[model samples]
Structures are given as C-alpha cells and as structure tokens.
Target: NLSVVVIDEAHHYVGSLGASFQGLLWRLERLARHYHARPVIIAASGTIANPREHLQTLTNQAFVVVDDSGASQSERTILFWDCTRDPKTPPSTQAAYLTRHLIRMRRSVVVFSNTRAQAEYVAMAGSDRSHRILPYRSGYSAEMRRRVEHELRSGSIRGVSATSALELGVDIGSLDTVVLNGYPGSISSLWQRLGRAGRTDLDALGIVMVGGDPISRSLLANAAELLERTPEHAIAASDDTDILTRHLLLAAAELPLEETSIEDGPGATAALSDLVNRDLLIKDGTTYRSTKQRPHLGTPFMEREASYEIHFQGTRDHRAVERISIRQALREAHKGAVFLHFGTPFRVQRVDSERREIVCIPETEGHHTQPALFRSLSQGRILEHLEPHPTLGIERIEALVVEQVTGYKEFDQQGRQVAKRKVTSPIISSPAEAVVLTCVDPIYLGIDPEDLFAGLHALEHALAKVLPLLTNGGTSDLASLTLRNGDAPSIVIYYLTKSHPSTMITKVIHNLHEALSLAEHLIAACSCASGCPFCVLDARCDDEVIDKGAALALSRLLGKISVGTALDSSGDEEG
Candidate 1:
C-alpha cells in the first residue's frame, strides 16, 4: 500500500511531463480510495515562485506551503563574466579555460551548458591528459550516466560539462565552483545551478559567462536587475487536448475509466468521446476500456516523437551507438551534419527516413556543422482577440507551420566558418498557436512600408528576448516572425512545440502592455550607437534588415498607444 509519496524537484513537473504526472496522480488517488488508504504527498522544490499553485495543479490537492525551515546557506561568490567584451575568445573556450583553471586549483567544478551538443563540445574542449572532463546529458546511455556520476562522487574525475539533466537533486558528491556557460534562461534555474556548489556549508564560487545572445547580453548590461528579479512562476498545461487524450487512453487501459472520472477532468469528457469515435476506446455500461493492448507501451509520456538509431560504419556488426529523437536527427543527424557522441565527432553518411536510422562514420576533420532552416506559416484561424487600443490589436490564432532544413554551414575548431553546403531534406510540418500584434497604421507612425517591416521585425526579436521574463519559459520556447496582412503588419509569436497549449500565448495577449514596455526598455537601455546583439539585433535572424531607430520609434508609439493615448498628430516622435 502506498502511504507516503515524495516528489523532489517538483518545479520540473511542468510541460508534457507535468501533464503525465497529473494523470498518474489521479490513478494513484483512485487506487488509494479503493484500498481505503489516504496517502500523504510531499512535493519539494528549491525556489519557484508558484510552488503551492504548481503542486496544487499537478496533484489536485490543497497544500499548506512551508516557505522556510530555518535553514542556512553558505556564502557563494557570484561573478558575472562578460565574455562579449573580448569577442576574440568564444564563450565555450573561455568556459573550458575556467574549468581547467578550477581543476588546477584542486577545486571540483561542474560547468552547466544549455544543450546536449554544447555540453559535449565544452567537455571535448576542456579535457586534457592531466585532467579528464566528461560530458553528462540525457542522450547518454543509462550505464554511461551512472559511470560519470560514480566517478564524480569518488573524485575519479576532476570536472564535468553537462546540460540541465545534472541540475536536479542528483547526489554528485561536493563541488567548489559552478560555471554557467550562458544564462540558463530563467532566474530560478540560475539559482538552482548555483546551489549545486557550496552544498556542504563551504564557500563557493559561481561564474556566469555572458553569451552572445540578446537575453544574455541584456543581463550583462543590467546585472543588478538580474540578481534582484523575482523568480518566474512555473506553468503547466494539464488541460491540453492532445496530452489529455493520451493520458485518458492510458488511464482506461490501466483500469476501465469510470464515466464520472472522465467528466471530472477539464477536457477528459471530449477526449474520451473522441477516443470512442476513433474506436480506440469502448464504452461498456458506465466505464470505458481501451481497445489497444498495453497502450502505455506505445505511448510516450513526454513530447510525442519518433526516435532514430545512430549506427557507426566500422563497428562490429554495426551496432547502434546512440538513439536521438527525430527533432534532433533533423537538426544534428541530417546528411552531412556532424554528430557528436561522448566528445567524439562523426559525420552523418546518410539519413534513412524510411527506417528511422542515421548512418555515420568517424570524422577526423575537426569542424562543427550548423543547420539552416526555412520556416513558413499558413492557414491561420483566429481563436481569441483583444483590442486594447484603436491602433493596436492582439489576436491568438491557430496556424500550420512548415519547417525545412535547406543547408548547413561548417565551422572549424576555432569557431570560424569554413564552408557551406546545400542538401535536400524532408519537410516537417505541424499545427501551432500564436499571438499576433497588429499595427493598424504605419503612416500614422511616420514610417514607410519598408521601414515598418524592419521596425516590426526588430520588435519581434526584442519581444522574444524579454517575453520569457513574464512567461517563466526559456528563450527557445517561442519563435517570432513579422508578416504583412493587407495594409497592416503583424508580429507573430508562437510556441516551438506543437503540443503546447495556448495558455502561454494567451498570457502574452493579456499582458501585452507589460511586454511592450519591457521591450522598449530593453532597446533603450543599451548603450550601443546603432543596434547590437545586446538590444534589437538577434543573431539568429538576417542582421542586414534590422533597423534600430525605426524599432525604437515603433516601440515608443506602441507603448504610448497601449495606455489609451493616441499617436501625436504632429508626427514628431523622439526615439
């Protein structure tokens, strides 16, 4: 019988994982009810803004929050290193240097990178004969990860470069320093990574190496603000239709789901009806049963996607080296792309889509590959709208997004572009939801069509950097594009994951005034003469079309009009 349940790192119970966990909790609660046993659940987290609400949403139980237990923290020396000041050295190289230096001082360190590929790259760059650094991420096999954890605990290894996979409550012995390769995208995450060090009441050092991204650069300019900002609230879409459908199917397969149970959830009733219509579930009397056998075996609780097996050319019998998701395969395991495994590089020989396999050969050449993508949006259907002002309109719409990888560029070990190659690849398309900001009149703002597009485009990039502040998500969680509809230009901000609900976009539309105010402040606070990555320029976009002055003017106009003020008739805007 389950008496007590403990959930550590409860902050991570968001997104698709959170949705699955919610369904599991419902099942457990029903089981406990049948057994006449009341189980107590304890959810613990480091530092999240909405811990109480987040836990309540996940488990559907009221919680009395315990904010503090009279615990004391060790002194941690936090340093924000502006790597952009010295553009000569890349941030990863600088991080490697810091790792080596810490190891030399007999201080165990953990360098946190944002992505798996970056973790591998940093590990490869930092490792030396004297001190060996290994990469630790989710992509590695279970045995490999355990080996690295054991080595770190026993002091067998000096350092490790890892992604967020290591940021959780994993016991990896003690450490003296933690180097953040870039802004981990949120304040809560920043503190969580810093907490990795100074675990045993010992003074520790934490370094934040500012990256070239706009958000990282903005944080560099306003380090005090970053340090003092409130932690973002954690949000989870438990009522998402797709997620609810999968979980309801699993629930029915576990035990015939009762009609009352189906109606208790937010969208479970409709999902169950759809499943019944599709012949995946059958209604017998008052309960529903799944037709498929062991539905959970085929259903993944995480984001739905196919996995691709990677096979090395010269291996004995050609055993699979690693397995990556299809999304990763398209970006990293495409034909001619350089795939990294355990700090070693391999050039992808072929991507067999039919078999869902990637064939790669060991790459002797020391270079990295970056994919170039072509993305477009179509078939927009408006879901909700808010006309806060006469000149501005905010609408949430569902649309179809198609993305294709057209080519890739190769960069040498020194971080210089070496060559560019074009390749044909399959196109991936999905349905997406977005929040669009429509600018009614560019003439009123005293800008031509060309300048208006540039201004809106710059505003889109700026918004992408700052929206995370309000949404409690990463910069990569949303993407933006500027398009013209008839006479008005609209900025479209959409989620990166297709299964994500419209809650995030809805939040943006509701608090657009705040978002616009933050965007304007971000652009104006920068000291650059024109535009730099620190402000209006996004490194991911075409830099030639970005106009800093026009962006500032448009942002000022929008900010003014959002607060019920009309545009000045004289058209003498001071930006």
Candidate 2:
C-alpha cells in the first residue's frame, strides 16, 4: 500500500482549467479513511506561494508546512544586458555568442531559449564558434537526452541550449552559468531557471539578454523589480462548475457518495439533481451512486492540457512531429505559415480545426511567418458594478471575442518584410469573462477628444504588456479592449483572461488606485521620449499609431484623481 505521495515541480500543475488533481486527492483521502491508512503528502516547488493552503485544497487535509531551506547558499551574480529592438543581430545570435564566450572562459553553461527553434539556432550558432556545445530539448529521444545530460555533467559538453523542458529539477551536476535568451514570462520562472546555476553554493553568473518584445524591454528597464518579487501563488479552480460536476460524478462512482457527508461547494443537492438530469448519476432519496453502465470516470483527475497534433502524413508517430496548444495552432498554423518543430521548419498545408490537427510538409524557405489577425469584442452585459474611485468605474461583464487570421507577413533574416499572403479561414470566437473600467471626462483634464481616444488606446496597449508582471498570467493569456462608451463620453477599458470564469488577476486590478499607480509608475519611469517599444508603442496595434504625449497626459490625469484631485483656478484639476 502507498503510504506517502510526493509531487515535485508543483507549480506546473496550476492552470486555469476547472479540472485538477484535487479531485483524485479527494478520492484518495476517502479511500484511505475507509482502509484506515493515512497518506502523507509532500509537494515541492521552487516558485509557489501559499503552500499550506494549496496543499490543503489539493488533498482535503490539514498539514504543517516546512518552507525554510536547510541547505547552505552562496552569492550569485545576475546581469541584465539590454539590447536595441530591431537589432542588427537576433537575440538568439547574441545568446549563441555569449555561450561561446563563457565556454571559452572554461565556465559550464546552460542557455534557456523560449522555443525549440530558438534553442536549436542558439546551439548551432554557439557550435559554429565552439564545437563543445549542443541543443537539448523535448523532441530528442530519452536515451539521447540522457547521453547529453551525462556529457554535460562529465565536462564533455561545455554548454547546452534548451527550452522549458529542461527547466525542471533535473540533475546535471554543478554548473557555473545560466543564460536567458528572453524574459520567461513570469518572475517565478525567471528565478527557477537562474537557480539551475550556483547549485553547489559556488559563485555563479546569470545573464538575461532582453528581447525586442515589450515584456522583455520592460523587465530590462526594471531589473530590480524582477529580483525583488515574491513568487506568485499557485491557483487551481477547484470550485469550477464543469470541474466539480466531473469530479462529483467520479466520487459517486468511487464509493456511492452520501449526500450529507461530502463538502457543500461541489457536492450540493442542486449539483446532484443537475447530474441526475444528465443521466450520469442516479439519486435514491438521500444517497447517490453511479450508473451501472459506466461506474468509472475515465478522464483522469488532472488539469487538462489539451493540444493539437501536427500530422506529417496522417500517421500517429509521436517521434516524427510535435503537439502545439489549440490556441497556438489557431494563431500560427494557418495555411501558408511556417511551423517550427524542435527547431526544424515546415510549411503548413492545412489546419483541420474540427480534428484539432494541422498538416504540414518540409519547408526550405529561409523566412519566418507572422500572422496578421483581425479581432473584435462584442458588447457585454454588466453583472457587477463598482465605483472604486470617483473618476473610475468598474464592472464585471460577459462578452464574446472573435479572432480571425486574415493573413500572414513573412520576414527574412535581415528583419525585412518579404511577402504578405491572405488566408481565408473562419473566425474563432470564445466567451469572455471580463472586468471593465471606465474613466470619466477626459476633456475636462485638458486633452482633446481625438487625443483622448488615442491616449486611451495607448494606455490599453501598455496595460496589456504590463499586467503580466503583477499576475501569474502571461501577456498571451490576457486580452483587453478599449473604446469610448457610445452612450457616454467616458472611456471604457475591458480586461479578459482566455481561461476561467473568474480570475484573481482581474480581482487584483479591480483596485483602481493600485492599477493606476502601477500604470503611472511604469510610464513615468520609462526614458523613451515619444513612446518607443519600451514604453507604450505596440507593434501589434492594427488600429492607429498611439500618441505618446497624450497617453502620458492621460496617465497623469488618472493619477491625480487617484491621489485626491481638486478643482484648480481654471476649473481644470489639481492633486
């Protein structure tokens, strides 16, 4: 009998999906009680906050947490090297150059790239300079990966470029350096990758080479914030209706759940009745049980990480191809686009959305593809409204978002636009649970109506790039919409997560004063004069060019209101 269960890398299990291992742990707890055997759980994560609460929620048990480390530590050196956007050389090329230099200095190194293709490119470039470096990613066979790890530890290989697949706690002996090709989306992930070096308490170096993206550039400028942040709390949607229904059905199948015995949230009377209507369960007065036709819930009790399979020739050989998330496939796998698998390039022939698959063939083209997207947000009904500040209005809303990949733009090695091709694909729509914030009377703050609109647009773009820093969600995981309210002169801002009905990120932003403070701090601290990429400029904006000065003016105006504004002599506003 299993008496203990240990989960490593616990942060990976936290996701927006309603389903999670919590249900399975609940079942295990029930079974253990029936058998009179207690199970002890130990979950370890390098970047998890609220460990005690997270553990209790996952296992339905009360336990003490021992978080302090007993191991000794040494001082580590972290360096941030900011590069110009649209640099003459790509970030990958720079990463390769640095890795080669470190290897020549006889320092063992691991370079972390965001994508497999990037990992491959970095590895290849480093190898051109020095032959002792190699690529290490997920696509390689287990034996091959083991061999590479052995070589890295044995000093046969001086450096290895990798993706997040190698970011976990894998033993590779003592190392001297770690290189980050780009910001890894979250402070937790950044620290975890850096922790891979200096394991032995030996002095080590961690280099962060910022990329051209807004997130990287923002982080590059605010390097101290990255190092000073506490890890984000890991959240699981245990009370999600869809997830609860599935688990409740499984609980009934497990051992005939007594209605009064289970917890109130997921196992309430109304939930059971709803399941009865679906024919998945039967209620016999006070007790409920599973149907005889199917007594087991085959869908595993874990967060569902769904992916679309890429078919080389309609064969299911996992080794020959890679799987990408459905969201990514929709955005990047449209016809005429280039797909990169483990750093190898392929041209997409077709995308079968119905089958959740993409068909592609080898490509000899020396260009990368970028999707040109058309997106819109339908008006939503307000479920909850709040006036956090006299000038700020907040609302919880339900809306629909449609994204269409209208075409793609190709770029060559020189960062020059090569070709633009149109794609005739159906629009992808999804329900959006959002929080809307409306700012009042921008014209009274000494800004013209046209500039007000441009300013709002620029603020929305900047918030979309900056919100990721304050929350666990990445920039891709969040979407926003900004426009002047048709019925009123106020500007409305909507922030939506691609997952979950409600998110802590939105809850945090509901504090208008805090949100405005962060926005003002970001803009005021940036050195860019007219909104370059490091400030408010958005390369992905399809509407119009943003007015940087107007954006700064609007931000300052909001800040004034948040800080208690008063009417000035001209009847404008002063704080």
Candidate 3:
C-alpha cells in the first residue's frame, strides 16, 4: 500500500484518450475508496489554473489543498526579447545571456522546449560555446536519453535543455537556475518543468522565456497570478467500464467468469451469460470468450497504429506516396500540386505544390475518413453562435482564443474579477476538445505571393524566443496559412491538405494562428501612444512593422470568415 502519491505532470490526465496513466489516476481514486483511505494529493504545476479542482476530477474524491507561491513574485520578470524565427538563437547569444547570470551559481541550469527538434537545436547551440552541455529528449534511443540523465546526475554536463520528457519525476540532481524559452502550456506543466531547476540545497530559480506566441505571453505575464490561482480540473467519466470489460475477458481467457459474490458486482454474472447467448460472448463451460464472429468484440477503443497506411502526394512527380511531415512535404510538394489523403474522408480544397502545403476548412460530414475525436469542450459543443471572450482561465471564458483584451479590467482588493478590459480573442483552441476541419489553397495561393517568400524569412526571426505552440495537435501534419511581404507583391497564402483525421492537423493550424496572431496583436496593440504593455507587440517579431494594419486585419478576417470548400486554380471545387 503506497502511503503518498505524487502526480508530477498532473495536468495531462483528464480526457479518456490523453494517456493510459490517466486511467491510472482514475483507478487510484477508486482503489482509495475501495480500501477506505481518504487520499491526499499535492500537485505542482507552472500556470495551470485550479490545481485542487483538477485533482478532484482526476481522483473522484474531495480533499483539502495547499498552494505555494514561488519566491520570484516581485522578481517574476517577463522580457520581450527579439530573435529570428529561423531560430538564429546562437549558442553564443544564449551562453552569453546565461553566463552573465548563473556563472557564479554552483548548481547547473535546465532549459525546456516542448518539441524534440527545438530542444536539440538549443542544446547544440549551447554546447558549442560551453563544456559538456547535453541535449535530453525521447527521440534519441533509450540508451542516449539514459546517458544524458546520467550525465546530469554526475555534473560532467554543465547545462542541459530538454523536451517535456524530463519534466516528470526524474531526478536531475540539484540545480541553480531554470530557464524556459516560453511559457509552458499549463500551470501544472510550468511548475513541474521549473521544479527541476532548484532543489534541496539551492533556491528554486526558474525563469520562463515567452515565445512570440500569445498563449505563451499570457502564461508568462500572468504566471504568478495563474500559479497562485486555483486550478479547474475535470474528471473523465465511465472510466471503470474498461477495467470491468478487460478483467471480464481476462477471466474468460483463463477460468470460468462467475459472480462469486466476492466481486461485489451483482448483474455482472447474468450480463456475461446473456451476452454469450446473444452471440456477443461465447461460453465454453464456465468460461466466456468473445465470439470470433464479431471481429471487434475484444478490441481496444483507440485503434492502435498499423491500422492505416498514410499516402502523401509527391509534388514534383504528382505521384501519391506515403504520408510525410510538414517540414519535409512542404519543401517537396510541386507548385499547384493537389493535396489529398484519407484519415476521415475529406473533400480537397486547394493545394500548393510550391509551398508543399494544402488549405482546407471542415466540410459537413460526408465520410469520416479520419476519426472524429469526442468534442470535449463546452464552448465548442454547447455555446455556439456567440463571440467568445474567454478569460483564458481568468475572469470568464468569453472567447475561445483572445486577440485583443480590453475594458480596463480591474481585480478587486480580494483578487476577484471586479471590472477589467473586455478582452477580445479569437475562439481559443481547447486542450480537451480536438476538432477536425478541411482547407484548401490554390496554385499561387493568391493571398500575397511575395509575403509567402518574406513571411517564411520573417517567421524564423519572429519566433526566435517563442516556444513552439502546437496546441490544437501535432507539428508534423500538413497545413495552410496566409502571409504578407513588405509591398513586394500581393499577399499570398498556401495550404496542404491531408485526408487523415489526426491531431496533427489541429496542431498545425493552431500554431500558425497563434504565431501570426501573437505577433500581429502585440504589434498592433503597441504601435500606439506610450506603447501599452497590453499591446506592446512585446514578442520578438514586429509584424506591424512589416504590415501592422494588414496583419491585424488579416487575423480578424480569418476569425470571421466561414470555412468553405477549397477552390482549384480555376476557382472550381474538386469533385
């Protein structure tokens, strides 16, 4: 019997599909009840709001909680540092920046990037200037990651940057300072990642770098407030069904599954027998087995990989092959090549072979070629037809994604939402509900041809210090996006469409939207009198400098435009 339980990355385990461990969080709660032990859960996170509630939802038990405020309240500084998006974050620059601060400290420092790619990049740059600084991520073989962890323990490695893999309960000895290139997505994630910085003998010195993304900015700016705030945790429903179902079959595979009355479930015995008679379960004496005839009777709900073969189209040859990632496919797609695939059946909109991309908006249901995730968010499912101005776990959830927050919002002396600026935002993406959409782009994309060239260059500079925000889904998926050049030519946009329905698509669109909007919003809100912090465009990129009004205008237009079918070069929809 375990006396204490510490759920490190506690924010991750809510929905049914999140992780198998999520099931464990639920099961542990049930086990506690079964054993009549009142569980105590102490969760630490970066800026995830409502720690206690998040706990309650996961454990299914009501409990008391304590909150810790990091000592850096007055010193919790946020900087709007600038860098090239192509990630010209030089090792020399990073090393110089840190050496100035922690060179004197005894313990080392840890840097975090959400993705393996960025983590590798930052680690490489740092190691070039320093001695024995290592890169830690899961992409490397288990041995490689283990070696990195081992090095951290021995102190041969002076500094390290890693993916979220290191954010959990792994011990990396003690550290002096922790730096984040951007605000981690949730409060819990933030604390957990930062917790690795300071420990035992040293003070917990954790610093966060906000990527030029809006979400990152909000998380960084209000993290102290967010950290100090209560977290709203939700529980997954009907989790025990899987447990009962699995054990029932396990028992059938071994011995006769009968209600011994010791099992406490009454109708379970009759239910299994009835299922056998109905041809759902096959009874071989006291044991029951799923009918081979039913094919999927004993299958797991989340269809494991090897279920489908992805086919990606080659731009140069116009030949369809297996699915590839955006960074690879976009560079390869031929100009004006058509993008199509079969995740859930989707109608092709437009394709850019040149950009190696596709643009699509969701079509009403035809054939769900890609699987439809359960719409887990209330705003997406319940509150439709209203412009949402959500507080982002603040005063209230109004907009799904906030663009501009206003109305001089003031919190009373009691730290409540008294009155404040009515924050306007784009419908924000929810971590819970994952939705799918189809989009298309034309031959030249026609949004702004030159900006297409320039924006790519700009993004590298834009996201220099920003965290990679793949909120809606994964980063390797196909995507469609609009861009602008400095009076070089008309604005152009491009998109890549994949037929499969995966979270990758959502991640692509959300990251693109977040990247452009954060830059545009900060630029527009600031390029005014006194350069308001609210709109300081404080992020690294000065999108407004490139085309201030145009960027904001484009972002707003995207929010309002209803998604439509993609138009072929001749402006005809693909049949």
Best by lDDT: 1
- Model 3 TM-score relative to the real fold: 0.45
Worst 10 residues of 3 by lDDT: 390-399
lDDT of all predictions, in order shown?
0.78, 0.68, 0.41
RMSD of each: 6.6, 7.6, 17.3
Candidate 2 per-residue C-alpha lDDT over 1-575 given as tens digits, one digit per residue, 9 for 90 to 100: 76998877766655333134676677778877778887788777776667777666666677687766554456899999776754887677778788888988889999998776577667755764345677788746677678878999888878999999888768664787999998775667788898888878678899999876655666766678668866666655555454566677887887888877777763355677788998878888878888854545365554334677886643345457567765567677788887655445578898887877788887676556778887766656656555546556555566677778899888664345789989887677766766566666555677776676678777776676555445534344466766556523333334443454545434435444556666767777776655644457554455664676777777777766643322223322211
Candidate 1 lDDT tens digits, 37-151: 8999988887789899989988889998998744446788999998877787788878987898889889999999987777887887788889988898987788888999899
TM-score, ranked from best to worst: 1, 2, 3
* TM-score: the better of candidates 1 and 3: 1
Rank the models by lDDT, top first: 1, 2, 3
Instruction: After superposing candidate 2 on the true structure, give the runs of residues whose Cα lies further than 4 Å from its correct spot.
Output: 15-19, 67-74, 104-106, 115-117, 124-126, 129-158, 211-218, 265-269, 292-307, 311-319, 349-359, 378-399, 407-426, 433-441, 444-479, 483-575
Against the true structure, candidate 2 reaches a TM-score of: 0.73
- Summed backbone clashes in each candidate are 0, 1, 101
